[model samples]
Target: MELKAISDDEKQRYKTVVLKFLEDLSYNLDDKAIINYINKLKKEFAPKTARMHIIRIRAFLKFIDHPIANLIELPKVPKRRRRLVIKVEHVRDLLREIDEKLSGPYRLKLKSAVLLSATSGLRAEELYKLRLEDIDLENRTIFVRAEIAKDYEDRVTFFSKEAQDVLEEYLNTFKPSNPLFSKKSLLHQFSKLDTRLRMKHMRKFFSQQSDRLGMPTAVKKILMGHSTAGDVDLSHYDFQDEEELKKIYDEYWKNFRILG
Candidate 1:
């Protein structure tokens, strides 16, 4: 079977998860064994992590054409409490506080990243995976390659002019050819700050900004790279003209902007 469809990282994760699960049993591959394994995982791991393990197992079983693959069922992952989104008025103030505390290249990197995340709604993983070529400063757009995307599908997203300006300055200074932000760099920079003020909160900022600005739900979902799989109508809506999406982005981009 073609297990090479997933990335090396994901494959390694599959290995680790499967091994841990197998160790819990006597290497059984029956539905009862699998369900029992999931029960064990529910106690040991977070609901989301446990759900992911079940998904991986299901995929693997299907790929190998195991008999029980069709019979396995996964439990719903419990909903997590929403994180507090950064308010619109506090946007510039938070950026200013972080910028003032740090200096030189570190300051530029974190500030630029936060601006991009706030404006574009790209996840930290997606932002870190960005390469210099992925950005189009003149057009105010960023192309997220499928491999780096969480959905395993390629899509385009946009940034505000304010974010574009900061990004341009950053590109001019760093002149990056590979990934724009290293995992270590993002982790180190975010670790120093309060949890409420961390890089992850920028996504919440983008969500709230979209609501406050009244961006169309369709446009907002596209910009955020959210999958419209179950929404029968939205899947078709997603296929409409890219230029129209860009127009909406351009029209509403400034509504999320931070003060200089």
Candidate 2:
């Protein structure tokens, strides 16, 4: 599993689930035992979350050359009917609320996080793992490292000038050598704010706004670190150089701008 490049968090989850399985079933390792375990998980967690647990458990069984791994099937997850759309005004209001209710370094750090997520479509975990070395302030670009990326693919993503300015201010003030944001700290502060928006919503905001502004689908996928496996443009056509991608992002910056 380690050689497979599974993320640390994923590895930990697998470990926890496997340990529980061993404690409950005591190496019974039969189809019935697995079914019982999955039933327990369904009662304890949401359908999607329980499905994830089963998937991880199946991977562990396969790793150990267990015959039942292939026979195990995943439970169906209900599809979400409503998708939340975040508008520019929503983001503006959230930022304004943060500015009014918070102060000092915490305020700047949270603001920087919001802008970066809104403009770059970076995942929350990716933002938390961001380091000073990953950022190029002059170019307004971020280098998402392979280990930190969800898909474990290294990619370059651009941020708006607004994000650059705020990030520069935060860096200049704190001069942090560690990761740019702490998952716990940022989430805690965000929860305190009186808004319907969550950190996850920022990435959706970026995706929607970019599409509205006419960003090519291929470019959007690349910037967001999404798999373009069968995409004709990304697969056959020559990929845009960093300068070209930056130019495209710059053209959409007006819509991305959250504050004056």
Candidate 3:
């Protein structure tokens, strides 16, 4: 599943299958034992979960066979794609809760990371690809290079004082030249505490914030990294000045109490 890398519960599923079929088992009971295991799982879990559990078991059982019993066959359950995405409010809550509960550098880093994503509409991959050079604190701009972006185009996004302060503090304490968005980019000291939050929720929350602020449709689209194929280019239109952009960003942060 696509969630294996991120899902907290997936490791147990993989281990159960490998451990059951490959470890200290008699050859003659293979087929019946596999069937019995499936039955037991079916009784204990829902049909859907039973199927998922079976996949892991079957994958490991594919090569092994018993001397007297025929090998068990697995049912191929059609994979269901997860369409549910985290809501914007949830993202806001996550950041808020983390800010209130988490302590020290880890707290500031997470607060800044999620806030940056929500405000700038950066993707998880984009967050991981950030470089120290990408952000210009003096100029108050973040340069998202084309190579790391899906559209193969460069874009500039601005930051708020809270983000700037956290980042500046982080930069002052940690010297990193390579990856900007990953946990390792923070510092060896924070490595133990870094908990990588998904970036998609940040983008979603940003969109909601933009909507609440009555941000122009075009500006919202650009901020969300969505461009209409036939639409006129935004850069070709009149662009707002840095001061105007700052007002919008500041107001957004103000509402969330992130300005403090």
Candidate 4:
């Protein structure tokens, strides 16, 4: 794929992993050296992380026509259980903790982000790249633009009445035009690494909430910006009306409200 085809976030991650590997290892790209590098990665990273880095390395080696690329076997990554962090009370506690830790502008920013993510099921990057025009407070909808989406497919997501109230206040106060979450401004007071991890979990919370509400698997995937194109009938023949989607969204999402 062309450089422009992938999002900057993904590219940056790949670059970081590759650079770290290069920095640690000598120039020898033989089977033994590669295996040693994999061992070192396995020691430092989780199995998933190690596997991802190995995949990237394998791709790069293939692109370069390296001989050892054929000899490299991918690490066997065991299936891991997903951590369910979508309990409304747990999310409320986290939001409260964030409020206690952060002050002034950034606190509100983070609160809005957490709330929005829980309600809308947007990926972190999608939330970051959200434009002012993408939000429709009147309609209670957020348009995840094609350009910012991980799959490069455009879709719509909705926020709850509670989330709409908070989001409206945030938009009025900050008046952000382009990027909704500006690291220089909104994240100025916070550790970027910590905030990034929190945002990731928040996205997972959205997915879990969707499941808890008994949303159809296809609808849940659509709401989460995950590709539903895997099913030919659902992708091409089935037409989901916006009103039907909104009804489904509202039905199960009301239970997601953060309780005191």
- Candidate No. with top lDDT: 2
Tens digits of per-residue lDDT for model 2 on 1-260? 77876668878988998888878999888888877887889899988998988898888899889888898888889998997888889999999999998899889999999999899999988999998899999888899999899999898988888888898999999886578788888988888899988778889998998888888777887889888787889654227787877787788763357886
Which 10-residue window in model 2 sums to the lowest lDDT?
234-243
For each candidate in the order shown, give its overall lDDT on alpha carbons: 0.79, 0.86, 0.62, 0.74
* Runs of candidate 1 exceeding 4 Å displacement: 1-83, 230-233
* Predicted candidate 3 versus true structure: per-residue lDDT over 116-183, tens digit per residue: 77667777677778887888876557788888777777766665565676677766765545675574
Model 2, stretches more than 4 Å misplaced?
1-4, 19-50, 56-70, 151-153, 235-238
TM-score to native of every candidate shown: 0.70, 0.79, 0.54, 0.78
Backbone clash pairs for candidate 3 read 130-180
- Candidate 3: RMSD to truth: 7.8
Cα lDDT of candidate 2 equals: 0.86
lDDT of model 3, residue 8: 41
State how far residue 16 of model 4 sits from its true place (Å): 6.2
- Clash count per candidate: 0, 0, 1, 0
Alpha carbon lDDT of residue 31, candidate 1? Answer: 75
Question: How far in Å is the alpha carbon of 17 misplaced in model 3?
Answer: 16
The better candidate by lDDT, 3 or 4, is 4
Compare candidates 2 and 4 on TM-score and give the better one.
2
